[model samples]
Target: MNAENPQSPPVASVPLYQLKAEFFKTLGHPVRIRVLELLSTRDHAVAEMLPEVGVEPANLSQQLAVLRRAKLVHARREGSTVVYTLASAEVADLLRVARSIIGSLITDQAGLLADLRAADRG
Candidate 1:
């Protein structure tokens, strides 16, 4: 683990948690999340996804580039249009799981708020 022995593989390789953190960081943008959600249903051209994502062409292009770099989506040229699709089905499943977990959190928070209100009324 020193500079001179840099080529040597450590007793343990890089931690999986660090890789997971990097993966989540790639998905940390609202625009990217929306783009992924749209692609989850079906492939879409840049033109087709523009209005749905409600961003300027420049912004959309930027987000697409990020997803492309992360290998989360694949882009192809169909005629003059640039179409994008999820790189794998697993991306869709991950989005779905995130939605489910967030939904549960929202429900739990609502219950907590209702309990607080009832206690205040007593």
Candidate 2:
């Protein structure tokens, strides 16, 4: 426990179950995913995102609060409004990877459907 003991390994802290739960809970909403996607493009105020995402002001605020708490997004006051942006470029990269996987899955499913249709017609 002594900081001066260079030979000692750092204490292993208990896993943060509550923090993990909150992070997943925050990401559980579709609106939050859309918000993250928009932020990945560029920083924007809640007002700007509202019109783009078609969510009401109150709903947007709620979603942003969840993202902010998870540290997935960061906010700063810009005059009258708070501009929100992804906490890091890695967050955008993660979204891109997720989208790629989803696209591949959808394409595979479509191909299967097409094959089934062709067989049925034959």
Which ranges in model 1 have alpha carbons more than 4 Å from their true place? 1-13
Residue range 9-117, candidate 2, lDDT tens digits: 7776657997678766777799998988998899998888988888788888888888877789999998999999899898789779989999999999999999999
Model 1 compared with the native: what TM-score?
0.88
- Ten consecutive residues with minimal summed lDDT in candidate 1? 2-11
Q: Model 1, range 22-114, lDDT digits (tens) per residue?
A: 999999999999999999999999998999999999999999999999999999999988999999999999999999999999999999999
TM-score of each: 0.88, 0.79
- Looking at model 2, which ten-residue stretch has the lowest summed lDDT? 1-10
